[model samples]
Target: MRLLSFVAVFLFSFSLAEVGFAEENGSSVSEERLTPEELDYLVNEVGNTQEESEDLPVEVSRRLIEEEAQVIDSGSGFMVIYDPEVTKPGQISTFASIAATTLKLGGTVYKVKSDRSKDDKFYIYGNFQWLKTPSYTLVDKMTIGFPSSSGLYLPTSGGKVKQHQHRYSQDQQGNGRWIDYTIKYSPSNWEPSAGVAGSYDIRASTSKTKHKGYIGQYVYVPTSKNGKINIKITYGHRRIAGTPSVSVYPAGLSITPTTATDTRSYALTLSY
Candidate 1:
């Protein structure tokens, strides 16, 4: 798919300028919130996938920061914001806010929403920018990668094609068991772009029996420049016990970026 670009409208007011200053000075900005009409407009813009084309108007983008929305990335000239209201428990809202912001800021948003009640949702947003990238250092089974200007190679459009399998190997011994599993998935082909890499930590539960057991694998692929990373997960019964079923879908992903000062770390949760 051809990626869409947006042109931001110019509409900055004097009052909004004060809000920006307050944010820089670490002061509490006024409680002036987005109006009902404005909020609805934002929700619609973010929710509609077809319109996910370009950057938001300069005025709306600025107001988002002024309202204390969660900042995803500010390093690039275009900033990304998540709706803070949705983060609060018991609050009902749409996930399109972040997706919309990402699209407006010249990125693509990928999501997997499941029908299962306890399913963990996943979203991936990527934008092409020439910033610092991170290099990976492996220690034991865990690897940590820190971003720096002189660190590793720049992330290209595509990544490696590999699969990581996680399965239950214990002998069932003619019995049924319920198991809780937590798995960490590292994209082998992921490289830091401007000091950021995409990774996932997924937790889920499955039932196992003598005839059927839990078996799954995560498939990672590098796509074109517009779609930097692509991941698909297939998990379910290994055998047919009583019409054994399987579910194959995408996993949750997150990207972390360090501030210019390198003192704070900001994690953008793409999952809804």
Candidate 2:
């Protein structure tokens, strides 16, 4: 009797499998209508399929992730990059960073009273930087000067030096003319009562490399015994460090001397 029972159970399972197989392989059972057993089989099979899909891992593409995580421009010569990774709902984290190099120039330029009339002086004050941009190297020459009408003069003012002017050239190529390049100027919130202070953008295209940057602190007639003046200038990037350097004549002499520091920030004081 036990052997007969086992045989009966095995036959029942085999019959159910055969029925499912026939239904899938275009058996004519559907020409009329599904029998109760057939309906039950179909429902259970569909439920199992849905459960399998829900358990499977979702596939994500790398390109899509890169597109979603993008860089945003601050529009003020700065940039911010954002990266996000989402593992599951409510389990997301984002990474953000600033560019290695950025263009920013700021500082003060004004005039202070002096004990002597010939000592009336102008000061170039401020912090300026080219950051990590290659423009520092591409730009071959630079100049800073007051307009002829300003009457302000560099310490080395000579018969040829109409106004206060400073210049730097790369590879000893000599000073370049301002009219040879593209210029851009920005409105500055820093307004000085004694001298004119503003932001200037200079760019040049000579060879394969492109160069551009901002004037950090500029004072047109920064000091005045008597005159309205404007300052225009350029700067050269140091060969080894790729930092900016300015030429100035301090002793009211014709010899222009390079600054004592790097393109990093510095204070300029003018005393009469």
Q: Which candidate leads in lDDT?
A: 2
Residue 34 of model 1: what lDDT? 47
Per-residue error for 28 in candidate 1, Å, reads 2.0
* lDDT per residue as tens, model 1, 1-272: 12322222223455688766654432332334445555554445344222322223223333432433332222213333231222367766565433312101123222322223433222223222111111110110111122222222222334632222111111123232222122223332233422222221121212222111111122112221122222222111111112212111122212221221111112222222
Candidate models: Cα lDDT each: 0.25, 0.30
The runs of at least 3 residues in candidate 1 whose Cα sits more than 4 Å from the true structure, single-residue gaps closed, are 1-23, 48-224, 228-272
lDDT of 2 by residue, 64-139 (tens): 1222311111012232111122235776443433223443333233443333444554334222333333322332
Question: Ten consecutive residues with minimal summed lDDT in candidate 2?
Answer: 55-64
The root-mean-square deviation over C-alpha atoms between each candidate and the true structure, in angstroms, is 24.0, 32.8
lDDT of 1: 0.25
